[model samples]
Target chain A: MQVTKREFLVATAALALASGMRSAQAATAINYWHHFASQSEMAGLMKIIELFGKSHPGIGVTQESIPNSEYMAKVSSAVVAGGRPDTGMVVAERFADLTAMGALVDISERVKGWKGKANFPENRWTGMSQDGAIYAVPAYAFVDWMYYRKDYFEEAGLAGPPKTFDEFLIACRKLTNPAKGRYAFGMRGGAGAFKYVIDVMEAFGSPIVKDGQAAIDKAAAVEAITFYSNLFVKEKVVPPSAPNDSYRQIMEGFRTGQTAMVWHHTGSLIEISAALKAGEQFSTAPMPAGPKAHIARVAYAGNGIMKDDHVDAAWDWISFWGEKDAAIALLEATGYFPASTAALDDERIKSNPIYQAASQTLDFGRLPNRFVGAAGWSESVVNPSFQSVLTGQLTPEQAVDRMIEGLEAALR
Target chain B: MKSVLHRGPLAKLGDLSETRYWVYLLLFPSLILLLLVVAYPTLYGFVISVREMRLTRPGLNGWVGTKHYVAMLSDRVFWISLKNTAIWVTAAIALEVAMGFVAAVALNRNVPGTKLFGVLILLPYFLPNVVAGHMWALLLDPRLGVINDILVKVRILSSYKAWFADPATAMAATIVVEAWHGFPFFALLFLAGLKGIPEDLYKAAAVDGAGPIRQFRLITVPMLRTVITAAVILRVISLVNSPDLLLVLTGGGPGNATQVLSLYAFQTAYREFNFGYAGALAVVMFVILMVFATLYIRLTRVSKD
Candidate 1:
């Protein structure tokens, strides 16, 4: 059964030729990981993938959706264990942590030469960049806004959504009717509740990071806490479950007519639309102004290359998100605001009355606090401290003091 | 006999297999696998607990002996979590054991419809923690909970209650849900043990006029002691280590009222990227579990041959 040298050489050559042909014909597979688990988000992602595939036949994109709650945990573990995807979705709050962990690749040079670069505003790029290196391409924005029952306001003899906090409180009191099991506000005090707490604190003129340092004005924070928690504690205009209501609970409260208003971002518009009428039963409004300022977070969620193996394809996919077709497709499906200002001119977004609040928000909305440990500090410290005040376990001053101490510890 | 034993290949092979070192030779692969799969990761976790290994902040990554421990000692959240974890584990275990024991006894009677009743009792355990947690969360929801509706309709309450939102009832509510999920483990084990018990003993006790309660206390209790100890230990370890139920139901909240050590450790690790502190919390949990297991086995005399 011994083979001759010439015969073996001939067989080897044939195998090599066959392998080379297969390799040449194979499409380049690039994986994209994201935390878009909703039906509409998945639909939007599928549309984007379909468009990308049609446009680039030689490149294959594999999309993986991780649950938002476990997205960072998976990303970090992947980075440590060396199984990172080619690209990953990045939100503004996680940009710093993701980059610091070396899970994101710097693509400043590519971004600099990108043709769609000008479509996004400078602030969007700022949210996507750190240390003079762009880590992600801004894809969509989550413009924070308040959704209220238009009919409820009308029935309460109110003209429209209040423009300031004092009027907002009055409206809350007027709309609340315990006999009907209706509360004024559905306060998000659970998992994703930290965002509104920070917004309110900032509204009271207590900047979390002032001059690149942790400089929370304790007195202002205390005042903010009192004002926010008083809606539950003193005013009694909030649900008893306010201290534990998260995104789902608060949204459910608003949709089911258990509450008059709920504060959330534009990302929830499609979901709310599915449950109630947009222009009649429910309406969106710019967040009410506080004594010092009006705070609305325009959080940009983007895409960044997580590994270097498929940098070109990764860049292609990320940059595609900014294109008008892709942005409009996503906005139509999920109602996520496009980060590209150019795409904002679409007739659907401009002509729709429901998106007026988002348009108003974009005028003055700012990015969320972007710094290392912001996530941990926000969810772990700020959320619970505020909840403690709401539950009457701690006074407003005590909760603010706790937040300050925890913030200092987190920074250190 | 001498001719047969004259260094044949088969004889020598048999002798080689009989040697004491051959046993170790056969065990080498399994021992290596154990070290790789179990021992290495455990040792790594311990080493991480003693360092400042933040995943995001690589510049701060280095050895920091006992720094995490010292920080944890003064951490107010840690203290609150420790207290909550103690109560959560203890109360949940007691409720689960009591319910499981009762359910097992009822099923062991071998009455009509026992099989269907058994299946119904075990249904909750088949659901994953996340599913069960969500189901209970919706059931006890303040805005639209069927439980509250029924209770109010039945005149048990005047109004709806946010079971998981209020500190007064958060832990208790979570414990009830956990007990429902975990009691089946004990019932399954106990049911098996109950079947293994002889009918003769019960007959003799009954003939002697030792009623059902007295017979269960004297015979069944003594017979099931080993199974009871093992089940309680396993359930306690499980309840203390897994915080998914509380995470979903309360997020350890209405102000950390239900914040268990595991949830705190999880938040510290994933949310904060502070693996050092998380590892320390984990090591503390590991030590507590170890001490409990050891003391429990010793006190129960389950190791006696």
Candidate 2:
């Protein structure tokens, strides 16, 4: 059919006007990618999303959960291949790598102007910052603590959790009974074992990185490795599976009464609580101190804008995680400690006796090692080097040498 | 073909199919697709191997002639990984072929429960690599594994054994898991080959007073050589390239005891963000695989047949 020029122009103008009106009325849809795969974590995320929906009805948020192990892989792929989410979860360990790959946008300006920023102190921002520019809004904290079987501790005549590494070793001797399938500690030596390895080194007065270079104290690191590996290799207080036992195995060992104690963070409280009765079956304690120092990591996990396509909506969603209601909701559902001091003051957190260990850790806990190559070095070099020690393939001195060499290579 | 309309805009195109250029025109789409999907990525990978392409340190990315390859010459882990890869591939192939042959021969008899047995034999293959890895991990778990429980009950062991934790047993455990998951691939192919063999040949052998085993060796081996060669090549390529099973079960550790080339390359690329080194690793893998396939085919004399 033939059409006149004036008629076609009129129709095109009408369609454009309709399209403009519809777009003006549409809600800003922003996508969030996170690594919260646990049922409790998902519930907490959904709770915050619900609260967000109520508070900001004009902005719509969609969430995607990636497994923690594969999160960085997927994020890097997205950055290189070009299908980035509006916002993503950022952990302290991944901050440097993420920024180096340009996976996250600089949100320093938005953070400076955020009203809820006051709730987070300087330390909370230290992990998510590089060169005085913040990339994420601190949402919650992963406070390192220990979960011990209370009944077993009582049976072994231990009055309370050990206060130092020496006491911890003595407790290990008393608590272990292999004939009954009981071990003192559930050691994590698999995929994420590097975190504890680094922490132990620091507790023995070995700095990982200082002045933007490899600063590991070889002697102190060797001492730390010897002490830690001895629990499995020489002391035989840990299970035979310590070399390959990761988070799931360790948790199972603690809950099933195979292990008397396991080191983890407060994030796993709800999972353990679901499996065992608090105080009667299990209790929490701060990580025992080493001879040279007491080291416990208080890693602040937060959200950041990955792509600024929907910058305003993404900022709104991430910043809302720092609000009191959002933080409290997450804590109530998942037992993740709130980064916001205002949320930490909530009665639900303060009234719980189980959270006392986490509260104590907050007083003196240090941030994780945050160099550009931290993840690669920890996972690739530190994990294997320590595992070699556990399996008796390398002496403590050799392992320390390997770690020093690897750290130097990484920093270079 | 339609006649050309000289007065319209489509005049030249309407007569195109009538010319010699039509052949090139028909091949043009396929050639474009091949270049886009295959040639481009392959050339890109080769280019990446000779250059620095780290995702984390983008500033340092540039042309670096043979730096990664030179560094790999003295890399202990790379050498260890190469040795382990050889052992892994050889061991897994041996187990898979043995298991698959037995299954295929047993199924060819067509017994009363052959169909059910066939399905059961293929069940492990139906599971994805990730699922099968996790399943085996739980079944062999030191703390609460059913295998450990049974072994203890049967007095086969004094206590539970951590299969994947101990370096001595980690590689063997992963090999067993790989064999279980991959055996069915060979079984299916071999079963089809068995069906295609002439029944008259067996009859003739029986008439000539040859026993079952001798007849089978003489008839079956020669007849299935082509199928066996093809199956082994495909399975080897898959086993060499795919790292998901090992990634899930071991992550190439208990201190590099289970480390293989593919897993090493993957960790280098993703975890370290050192794509240049990973690309170099990939190039090495490609060369090794090409050499293996060529030598294997020649040694077997499958092409002469």
Candidate 3:
């Protein structure tokens, strides 16, 4: 029954350690929904999740993949049903809307302490912040680029990729040979053309939305639509098929050498490079500039944590993914550019020519407008109106007018 | 007392009451299920239609009675979608019926491989609508498609043209895809009706010195009237409600040139996140379909007699 003080202190310390370990192991699981459905990308995501789970042994992460087109609907339904995933992927522009709804947790303080904060580019962080509060973290940034067949450019006697809008048009015309069943360029023109049109408008120096009003009737936007339409209708540099093509169709056309060039994102370049290595020779260049200097519309896709219940766990999951090492690992595995500056400057990324070329454009990139209720601005108004103008169903002026009316109604 | 139990009116009343009670019990589960699954959502949709609901601004959404309805009435896209739906339904029904009747007659013959041909003709109906849309989109693709290549090689057309991209052709392309997928259903139903027709009637027509065309016009057409009516009504309802195929194939585009009401409502609800406005659009679409269905049923019944 006689006890030494040293032995008693050691026993107390051992008891405290045991309780601490037990509590750490009992942490709740956080649900993470993402739009990455590709096998390789999903595999990379799984690795990140595994790393997070290992580092924070108590925090279990449940990841789900929803198709990109249905992601918004699924997220909305989940939020309305009051069972939103603990963390999920969201577009940067819609962060404002989500924040306004109080559906997203502000991670400003948590992010400030994150070791990777200094590694993220100032612009990337700007996208994640609103009114001095950071709502989410940027995981990756994607921008539009002109993907072309290198062999086709050489065959057409072009020295290199077109440097400006006029040169791009000429290249398209020179490469087009209808008799040979080939087209110079391909553009998506249906309900999905808005992405391309938006890029073009940005390149033309048009603001997508200003003060909750439609600016499509502005001169820059009109010029952008006219320029795109001329490629299809006037010069006929693009095939008639451009109007109906989807992203896949356009990518296929460019990959199969059916078209010389297509307006697409950097993620597409990764896939196209693989196809190129398989005997299809292609390269990418920054999207051609309009009357304004070269400008690219950048979009981000990253994970978001719900504000309601799982705040701490969500923050842990986001911080784990946003770390410099984690981002670099993901970028290397998935062929996507990291949004973090340190990851972007990592020797492995800087040495890659495609990544370097893509990163140069990211410096000049800008996010789309963050109007609260303008989610459908691209699909409902921009695409249809652009289609109408390109197909001669409406004149450029009329198309612009229609788009304004539609945007006004949509924003209302 | 035994005679009363065996022959009196009380026993009949008891039997009738028992039969009624059992019938109600038997129907109860299905009735409850229908109310829960169908009726409840419909009622909820109406309630939602009166609210100003935005998916992104969930907390801000609140009751705004008749506002969504008024907005829909003034919405030009709504009008365009309604017009497109009308075109789709009329064209789909007319073409499917004609094609189905011809196909049913051709396959009704006792020729070699007739049964195999009949089954092959019905195969498209078995395919899911999304797959059928994608399949048609591929087949009709102007750039890398087999159809355009063949057409240009054979000098049928001067050059390749985008079938689904141009406004003039987009609606036609949608109509073709819809009709192709729908004709098989009509063919199967009409064939069943054709087989059920008494062969003796046709033989009597032949003996009356009537030629094949005359017999078809008189006996076959008149006899198949009921089946045709039913097929037309079903096709109309389907064509009006199911533009999901067009949504996939053309996405109601190349400029809203192919937008139907169902696709419009979906875009409004899911894409735009204007659930209240979309719910109002859905309500209007439902009413329109109901009116069309009622008229179709009456027309079919009158023709059948």
When candidate 1 is compared with the true two-chain complex, its DockQ is 0.75
Reported per model, the fraction of native interface contacts reproduced equals 0.82, 0.85, 0.77
**Alpha-carbon error at B56 in model 1, in Å?**
2.0
lDDT of 3 by residue, A1-412 (tens): 9779999999999999999987666557678888888776887898888788788877888888997777777777776777788888777756766665566777788888887778776777776777898878888877767778888888889988887898888898899997776889877876558777776776788766777676653787778888888988888877677777888788788777788888877767556776775223777788777767676667776667875466787888887777776787677667777777767778877776665557767866667667766657778887888888877888877787776777776666
Alpha carbon lDDT at B125, candidate 3: 90
Q: Model 3, B1-305: lDDT tens per residue? A: 88765786867766767775867867899999999999999999899889988876666589999988887777788899989888888888788888888888899887999889988888889999989998988888876678888998999977777898888988987888888889988888888889998999889989999998998899888787788777777777677777679878888887889988888878877777888888898888778878876887686675548
Model 1 per-residue lDDT tens digits across residues B1-305: 88875878878778889998778878999999999999999999999999998987899999999999998888999999999999999999999999999999999999999999999999989999999999999999887899999999999999999887788999899999999999998899999889988999999999999998999998898889899999999999999999899888998998899999999999999999999999999999999999999999999998882
Q: How many clashes in each candidate? A: 0, 0, 0
Q: Each model's TM-score, in the order given?
A: 0.95, 0.95, 0.87
Q: Indicate the DockQ of the complex predicted as candidate 3.
A: 0.45
How many Å off is the CA of A341 in candidate 3? Answer: 2.2
Instruction: Please give the distance, in angstroms, between residue A178's alpha carbon in candidate 3 and its true position after superposition.
Output: 3.2
Question: What are the clashing pairs of model 2?
Answer: none
Docking class of 1: medium
Candidate 1 Cα deviation (angstroms), residue A78: 1.0
Residues A1-412, model 1: lDDT tens digits: 9999999999999999999987775547789999999899999999999998999887888899998989999998898888999988999999988988889899999999999998987898999898889999999999999999999999999999999989999999999998899999998888788898888999999999865578999899888888998998989899988889998999899989999999999999999999999889999999999899999999999999998887888899999998988999899899999999889998889999999999999999989998888998999999899888888899989988888888888787
